[model samples]
Target: MVGVSKRVEAPSQGNREFTMTYANFAHIRDIAYDLTGITLSDHKQNMIYGRLARRLRALGLSSFDDYCNLLSEDSPELHEFINAITTNLTAFFRENHHFDFLKTTAFPNIIRKNMASKRLRIWSAGCSTGEEPYSIAMTLSATAGFSQWNAKILATDLDSNVVDKGRRGIYQEDRCTGIPNEYTRYLKRNPSTGEIKIREDVQEKIAFKQLNLLHQWPMKGPFDIIFCRNVVIYFDQETQKKLFARYHKMLAEGGYLFIGHSENLNRVSNDFTSLGKTMYQKK
Candidate 1:
């Protein structure tokens, strides 16, 4: 975040000639892939230009080449660049069924099985702006006997800016729209700011950290449930295979793994058994 510039200017309304070259685009794509494991295709060249153009303008750089040159050097701007380009489109309960599964099936089984210890661990991988992890927290808290269980959740994203927001546990009022009615009790309005805030009970249950799924994880444990929805859709086939394999190894036997609605595991890794659309249990 230190290296990334914060200055932003609105794009001129009409079409403008592009300044970036194919080589520059290729380099940017490579950087995103290598650093974040996100595949930025050629069609997204205009998008890359639009997004990075802000960074260039903020830094007062003359050209895309100037920006490309910084990539080869040790620059903190790279951190901001990924944060800018990486998509963070999410809302409370964006995928309702996944949370439904957690409340109805997965969590009930976990609560039943672990009643003695009353412990639960959930990972919200690629948690954007804390909505996903907070959603998990609220769902668990609303469950019967949930307070009796020592529930913990790990929420992570590659974007530091979003991670910071997640840590703050605040959002605009409209962002609370899609959250379920039952869980709305945990959300209260900040009278001064008119913004939504996740209650302390739900907020404290989660630990949000900045993480790149491609990197070596310091954690070791068989997580009871992992919510990696929509994160792997950006990765290539090989990367997805390796990522899922690592997840399989980390997930407890019979633990649940939830993926994006549009993502599938066909021909990827067979370490998990499919439990219908966008759901798998580690085999």
Candidate 2:
């Protein structure tokens, strides 16, 4: 939730001795891409320094070179370093309209048309910390009579740590604030631990996996719906185009693709026809 601002000057050339350098920027960019498939542009020079500088100080490393060397050491510290730099901001029902659309339009249509199939598959791409996929499961359970139907939600993220956390199905109360009251009733609150955990039935419907969008997709899918919202902002235009194309291939005929409000397929790809306002149906 921290805002990343533009850097006024380069760390090495600027008057400030503690500024980030070109070498540091390159190292951090490569590390980010290698670990999370997120490409840090030159504009993110300050962001790289701001997010990692404190870690460097804590590790007693005074220079970017030393920090980079530390990252290359292949220790648990290196894994922590990668986890700290990757952004994992997410909340339940963060974008409610997408869920509403899925419940009212997509799910109903899929159920009626695929009655013979008797199975539904939904993919929550970039499912940060589980909220998105959990929301999907809740929607299906409430609207689609989950007990009678066979349904599975595949939730994936590039960050292994967050993926593990999501699989645990535990969340802070504040994170569940926007969740519907009905859904809230299903969440179990443990007095001893003061942690809220998702109900077992809902958790069982979702399978969490670690996935890198930039790399080759491992799962075979002709998914009915793919919720890849709010993740492409970090990618370049070419990457975005390629990703959308891949999504087009992954989606089944008449399958739906939901992207972030800030993203569009207008310039990215023509394989998907716009379904109005951040929604798309594969052509």
Give the alpha-carbon lDDT of every model. Answer: 0.86, 0.82
User: Each model's number of backbone clashes?
Assistant: 0, 0
Instruction: Report the poorest 10 consecutive residues by lDDT, candidate 1.
Output: 1-10
Off by over 4 Å in 2: 1-8, 11-19, 31-37, 54-60, 70-81
After TM-score superposition, the amount by which residue 268's alpha carbon in candidate 2 deviates from its true location, in angstroms, is: 0.4
Candidate 2 structure quality by residue, lDDT tens digits, 214-261: 778888988999999889887767778988989999998999999888
All candidates: TM-score: 0.92, 0.87
- Model 1 TM-score? 0.92
Tell me the lDDT of model 1 at 240: 96
**Residue 170 of candidate 1: its Cα lDDT?**
93
Error of 1 at 150 (Å): 2.1
